[model samples]
Target: MKNKPAFATMEALAAVLIIGFLIVIFILFIHPPKQFADARNVRRTSNVGTILTALNQYIIDNGAGPPGVDGIWRVLGTADSGCNINCAKKIPTGIEAAGCLDLTPYLVPKYLLNIPSDPKLGKPEITYYAVRQTINGRIEVLSCGLESNQ
Candidate 1:
């Protein structure tokens, strides 16, 4: 009898390669990379922490926390509106102002050079929030988009 071919035919090799390519595609679709997501979370946490620290410093220097547009003491605002008072108002300067909470105290040559925006900012959703709780009279900064539980 004639000896069988020791190696696969060209057609069989092509078929195997095609199958491998398809499998790779499927795997990529099923499990996307988490690096981008993790990076965004890290940046968000850093931004939040920076703002919180600046707020504390502002309080120490001014002898009072920056005033909220609604009131000195306010509940935490939603991500959509930022802080409770003037959620839509643009902060021209960081100093205390009416119709909005001014973070200028933290921005102008003091704490932060500029206000750090959320990674998903301008997406028609709130990503960050702040409020001064009445019970303890402390400023609370929050990042709604933070990935980690703590």
Candidate 2:
């Protein structure tokens, strides 16, 4: 009967609406854009923590700060191409202040296998992180690129 065809058309429409609802839920709740930023932030925090831990362990083992100095902010990456010969050294970036501290000698293959970089916008040469010793001799590590505004 004609009613049977209309019923079938209604069933198809209902199925399509259900599918649309599920897709909306998936996009809004299961895979929102904010989740990606949050994940990057978590990675940044982990990188900071690992750097701090390695720096602390080095101090405990050697009985002295790695830099052998205090109260200075040292960027934790290689100098940019602009530095020319000083490329091997750390240079300032937008994330942190001037002065580069290459922890490779102090941390590489000893405290950490190698220095870790930012989850994004970081390379082996320029870790988007910085480390400094407070005037009181406390070591502080920070991530230059933190996502999620956190």
For model 1, state the Cα shift of residue 126 in Å: 6.6
Q: For candidate 2, lDDT tens digit of each residue in 1-150? A: 335455577799999999999999999888877888788879888888898898888889989888633665555766653211121223343433354567788888988888887777777766767777887778987776766556
What is the TM-score of each predicted model, taking all chains together? 0.55, 0.75
The candidate 1 region of ten consecutive residues with least summed lDDT is 90-99
Provide the clash count, candidate 2.
0
What TM-score would candidate 2 get against the native?
A: 0.75
* Candidate 1: residue pairs that collide: 79-126, 94-103, 94-104, 94-105, 95-104
**Clashing residue pairs in candidate 2 (N, C-alpha, C atoms within 3 angstroms):** none
